[model samples]
Target: MTELSLIRNFSIIAHIDHGKSTLADRLIQVTGGMTERELKEQVLDNMDIERERGITIKAQTVRLDYTASDGKTYELNLMDTPGHVDFAYEVSRSLAACEGALLVVDAAQGVEAQTLANVYQSIEHDHEIVPVINKIDLPAAEPEKVKAEIEEVIGLDASDAVMTSAKSGIGIEEVLEAIVQRIPPPQGDRDKPLKAMLVDSWYDPYLGVVILVRVMDGVMKKGQQIKFMQGGTVHLVDRVGCMRPKIEQLPELGPGEIGFITAQIKEVEQAKVGDTITLAKGGATEALPGYKEVQSVVFCGLFPVDAADFEKLRESIGKLRLNDASFTFEMENSAALGFGFRCGFLGLLHLEIIQERLTREYDLDLITTAPSVVYRLTMTDGSTQELHNPADMPDPVKIDTMEEPWIKATIYTPDEHLGSILKLCQDRRGIQLDLTYVGGRAQVVYELPLNEVVFDFYDRLKSISRGYASFDYEQIGLREGDLVMMNILVNNEPVDALSMVVHRSQADPRGRALCERLKDLIPRHMFKIPIQAAIGAKVIARETISAMRKDVTAKCYGGDISRKKKLLEKQKEGKKRMREYGNVSIPQEAFIAALRMGDE
Candidate 1:
């Protein structure tokens, strides 16, 4: 085994919007992993939803080169972790890939809820942490105050933490030197067989499954046979690729190096995150360290606006799932939505990413329902079934017992919004556990059912709190609840997007809003759309979406009969595209926007 001193590894950890992606961009560029010409802000984050929303949804690794103050060139592996609680498991996996972490605290915002959660997680993972105050270039920057907060929270000295503006490129050099000095290098047996943990992977039009792996032992070479441990699959090595910051196709990978090895792996599940990739007969260590199996926490239904596009949506999801391990799927048939899939995700943001990618990246028009959390139901006979769409929920009488997942939710917000935040949490069936005061801000921890946060809670929290509330939650366990699964129907047909599991009392408002949103989102065609909310047999609420009444009444009047006939044909084509099976008339943006929204 090589000594650990040669490998320098660390992860950039922070809350959403805290410059995690920006700092990664700087580190990658400075380390010469990516060239100026190849530089794209947030290059490590590839998902469109992630870049557009200014957050890192998955953890990414890029190897970089740096020169110490004494002129020694050292290899620095920078692990960029997701900045939200929904992705805490991901951050933990990233932590396993490194020996140290750069805990980024926003200078202007001080320590937010997510930042604290990640720092604690890093500590729990036993990775040495180096605190850094970012956004120092902002006019309201208070580096010293944040430094003190970090010291107080992490129980470490604050002097070593550097203040830097990743955007202005200030103090970046110093930060680089600090990483080399504070973080230790990777140590592994070079003589053993090759074994590495798959961290993140992406698909390029040219190179498929551009995988990022942290080598655990031995060496990887071109044209070698490999097997994935978790899924028990094998791949014939195509070519070994190295990314010394900017990606380069290489002939081999040694211990301590972070790179990719592709072997024409067509199926994404075969090569998955946290899976150990080793030689078929023998490879380094014969086993890998620190691979965590990832699971889905949130679920949603994906339906194409045009039923004919059902097959198209399914194909897009399959391709999307190739590189995105967090997205999963099972075919779902809805009396309302027709044939679709009940897709699983890591979190709400995860669900949105898949939906957006399908509509925006794949150029497929779709209608997604309100996001929902899965419920574990134990039948009276002890049989178990996990519920995703509310429609599939067994009848309450048959269920005998149902345990909805609960999360220990921590909401951080300014003092002014504390009362509203508390009230909102309480109304969502949240049980207040504790509240802490930090400067003029507050952090409130509560235990709430996952069903609450999966739907309108996210939107309501942001709205009532004026976007000041930051949220983080990890599953605590499940709790017994008098729950009702609210299923929505259009013209008496169930639409998966409108399904939800709501408390008995809140069902009315949730169903009303869901139906209204559907009425606005589902397009109008030759027939009007009727949206209804029903709890089993009886309908509690209903709304209507009318067909297009006056679209293009003009063209036929000024043209010849044949031309007028052509116009009618074009109009019919337009209707076919806009029409859904239900009683709603909507446009494309409305469909995408509806998917982007959650009715609180």
Candidate 2:
């Protein structure tokens, strides 16, 4: 076992596209973790979607051996975390397992919204942060300006910041040296009982459940009995290992070491992230402070395009949940979309990632409903309920008061785009909290309804700012609002999947936009199909899909006017009767198109 002083545990934290993963690649290569032939870009990002999007979804850990200038080998455990706000929980968990963090800043872009957010989290975890100004090779890079911004905005000293171009292999040696010289080693005692923190876990087809752990107090070895403190489930450890970006078997992991273990656990749910693991026979009496349960903010329904694929969809979702514990789902059947499941996600990006994974990995076609935020409802009977789906809402008369979730959002944009960005936020019923100028950029903070920002707000911000704006938000608790459920009816029948909760003041415009979009999406039927958006007994918007006429008078050529009139009347009566009994067969494409109204 290596001495505690020779081991360093740290994570790389930065904003999206700020070269966190690239820096990881450079470190792994220089330390000879992988040979040149086997090395590639983004070696830690294993998922196809992650590589394609050039973003890290899951935080990856690797153990590297580096020979410092003093001729001493040090064991460095580096966690490469995601930079997006949707994956902030991943960053927090990584920080909890590390003693320090490399705060990477884009030399050209300077301090962004996520950069500040992540740095604050690192400070909260009491991590020793070493600033690294990355991408200095860029033509617009100004390392000195970025260093000043780090000191002014984040309050972190940047006088000794390291300058490196991760892509070109510049200043890599200094980065490794700084990690060894500056970051402190983890503190733990091997003589105590086994107390390891479960950082993350995923399901492996070959090995049931693969758990990533950081040993805090004692030794974790193969063939030992361990218990999950939160779950109270015991299992026999089958294997113990570490990742060099590839699995390397180890006989035992001592204190202050990061490694993995397979305990013959059946599912990842049994091995909760942030849970304390200890010896089953003689474990610690008190558990460590674990992470809070993740709350899903956005809710939407996922239905198979074909009814026959319902069972397949269920199996696919269950398997996906094995790896992603933050994603929650429940079996729900919709009248309009047939059998499906209602899934809850942390945010819009999380929902998109899950949907894309289901379609690409499982090869299943899906139709997603409109996304909505959770609401708290107080009943006249002095009871409270959380509303996930609008279709499941209680009677309006029984709802004494409704409170919708709110969020505190911070946006960083260039000075030129500040006008449009502020207008966009204000148009969404936002209350501006503060606005300040940092260098040539503007930082704006606003309190906006979570529902308004859920639909296409990020996309709009990106487009208006020419992709120069960075946005991040945290959910503040719910507040009382004049919210009402808007229902969409096709053929005078309400579609549960198309229902949503909206603020009363903006309900009319939102309802009208949806009704108009559906008018164009739904195909022409045999009889007139009247589509209406309504709240309670009042209709807010209406549209009609004209009937496909057969031209009953076509065969009455050269006939008298009276004969043509009689035939037309007969056909009109038949059409009216058919309108009452005919069911509008809305194609799957229509549902998909109508739900994407936010894009328009």
**Who wins the lDDT comparison?**
2
> What does candidate 1's lDDT look like per residue over 1-600, in tens digits?
224565687898888888888988888877767668989878888777888899887677776767788787787778888887767776776777788999888899888778878888888867878888899989999888887777765687888788899999998998888888887777777887777887766665676666677787878887778887776777788877766555678777778777777778666566666678888876534455566667788877777778898878878888887767677799988665578888888888777677777888889876675577778888988898888777776677888877788999888888998888889888888899998887778889999988878866878889988898888888888788888877777666665545667788888887786677767666665655677898877788889866666555474556567886776788777666555533443454664565555543
Q: How many clashes in each structure?
A: 20, 0
**Residue 541 shift from truth in candidate 2, angstroms:** 0.7
Off by over 4 Å in 2: 553-561
With candidate 1 superimposed using the best TM-score fit, by how many Å does residue 144's alpha carbon deviate from the native?
Answer: 1.2
* Candidate 2's TM-score: 0.97
Put down candidate 2 lDDT per residue, 7-96, tens digits, no spaces. 999999888889988999999999999999999889999999888888888888999999999999999999988888887776787789
Candidate 2 local distance difference test against the native? 0.92
lDDT (Cα, 0-100) at 86 in candidate 2: 83
TM match of model 1 to true structure: 0.84
Q: Give each model a TM-score.
A: 0.84, 0.97
